[model samples]
Target: MMIRDVKDMVKMYKLLIRFSIRSRMQYRFNFWTGSFIAAFIAFMEFALLAVILSRFGTIQGWSIAESAYLYSVLTLSKSIYRTFASDVHHLEQYLVSGNLDGLLLRPLPVLLVLMTQNVSIRFGELLLGFGMLAYSLGILAGKGQIELWSAIPLTLLISLNGALLLFGIALATAATGFWLTRISMLQNLTEDATHTAIRYPLTIFPGWLKGVLTIGLPVAFVNYMPALYIVRGEAGPWILALSAAASAAVVGAGALLWRTGMSRYQSTGS
Candidate 1:
């Protein structure tokens, strides 16, 4: 019975995702424009990096190529996370206006429905991310710094693991809305700023900030720790196992927080 129920949920999730895509396409201009703007923003961000790197040639021993690789990996992982859990990142809206009340009434889980909300694919981000990742890897491979065969697949593994790590962090942050009812500032610090920091090597950050990101949020496990082994070969393959472990632990803790918070939820009625 449990297996059957799980299968049903998967089927329903697919149907909801299709409904979401059609709903989004109903306004093709808006959807495409959003994609264009996202791509443009990514381009501009990279351009800023280029200008900085052109002057200094490197940041704390990280070349432009290596930095781009970090950005691309994180971007791809973020794309995956946002693709699935866009609404999970916006739980404050539900908590504020009581939209979550409607979700709770659904036969399916509230979290599952939330995952299906605003389910548009991030095409622009994906394109730029893939382009940068390929370009960076190509440069490294040319220099014989890394092997394309093993590196590509392993990087992909890390991307998937990174997505889970990101989702776990986002989930936990959003779960805090159950208590605080306002988590935008926290999200900006935890999700936005911390992610931006990892685009560069962690070595550049001050000790306190690094400690917060590494211990408090643990985003370091998503990209930096694994990248040490993948791109630079500075760590052993054990780093991958460590990252996988961190992802699972955080995800489990986030799920627990979400459940505990739900128990204390108070609905503001319509």
Candidate 2:
């Protein structure tokens, strides 16, 4: 029965994704234009990092290419996260207008339904991120800093795990809308600010802030912690296993929060 239900949801998710794509394609110009703008913004971010490295040489002990690799890793993760679950991050809009009441009426899982809405592909980010990753890894490989054979697969795995980490963060943040209808401020601090901060080395920040990032939010697991071992070889392969475990743990915690929040839910109408 459980397996059957899982299959049911998968079928439903695919059908819904098709509907979403069709709805957006009704405005093909907007779709293409928005995609280009998103990709351009992502490119500019890496360009800024590259410019900083050109002037300063390296971020602490990280080389320019390594820093670029770090940026690409996070970008790929974010692109993956947003591609499959764009509405999860924009949940506040639904909560504010009481649209969630409609979703609650559906037989399927509300989270899965929300994940399918606004299914943006984020091709720009993916293209640029892979381009940067390849370019940076090429440089690192040439210098014998990393072996392309192993680094390639591990980087892809880490990027996928990083996407889960971000989705969990966004899930927990959206669950807060159960009590507080307006969540933009909370999202800003948790998702926007923290994401920007992690683009650089965590050690560059103060002790308290670093602790907040590592413990309070744990976004560091999304990139920095794994990079320590993956790029610098500061530890053994155990870090990769730990990073994967951390993603699962965070997702479980987020699911717990979502259930608790649902129990306390009060619709604007009611």
Candidate 3:
């Protein structure tokens, strides 16, 4: 029965992907242009970071290469979340416009329907992220700071977990839409602040702020902890183990919050 259910999910996912692709293809030029602009903006952000590193030489004892690695992990996490779970990111639209009722009426699980409703054309950001990660890893490998064989697998694991962490945050933020009706300000503030904060090493922040990020938001577990393990190899075992645990905990909490919010949902009368 479990296998059958898995197969059914795969079939449904494929159908959803096909529908999303066809819909987006209707404006192929727009899709491609949007992708290009996103990639360009990401590149420019990194470029600006590189310029700063050139002047400052290091950030809280982390070199430019190390910081790049951190940036890449965060970028990949955000891109992955944006690509796969974009519906959650845009949940305010559904709630405010009454379109969420249509999703609730579907036979499929509401979360699954929301997730596969759209597959964003954000491949460009993913590609740029990969490039940055590879470049940083190469530099570190040459300096004997990391072993590519082990680090590659660890990076992949952390990246996946980090993506889940971001998705969980997005879920919690979107869940507020049930009560707030519109949550763009809250969502943007949370996402933008967290993203900006994680771009640099967490060591630079004050003790209280660091504690808040580590315990409250827990974005630190997504990149900073893993990056420390990767570059210095000092916290390998504990960081990796804790990252997996934190990811699971955050995602579970987010799911619970979402369910609670759904219980309170009062659809906008369409």
- Against the true structure, candidate 3 reaches a TM-score of 0.96
Q: Write the per-residue lDDT of candidate 3 for residues 1-270, one digit (tens) a residue.
A: 999999998899778867887888888898899888999999999999999999999987899989999989998988988877778888988988889899999898787788877677588898998999999999999999999999888888888899999898888888888889889999877677888899989999999999978888889988899987888676757888898888888888889989999999998764
lDDT tens digits, residues 161-267, model 1? 99999999999999989999999999998899878888888989999988977788889988888889988899999989999999998899899999999988987
CA displacement after TM-score superposition, residue 184 of candidate 2 (Å): 0.4
Global lDDT of each model?
A: 0.90, 0.88, 0.87
Model 2 lDDT at residue 176: 87
Better of 1 and 3 by lDDT: 1
Sort order, lDDT high to low: 1, 2, 3
- Candidate 2 off by > 4 Å: none
Task: Return the clash pairs for model 3, or none.
Answer: none
- Model 2: ten consecutive residues of lowest lDDT: 261-270
Q: Model 2, range 25-53, lDDT digits (tens) per residue?
A: 88989888888899899889878888998
Residue 222 CA error for candidate 2 (Å)? 1.1
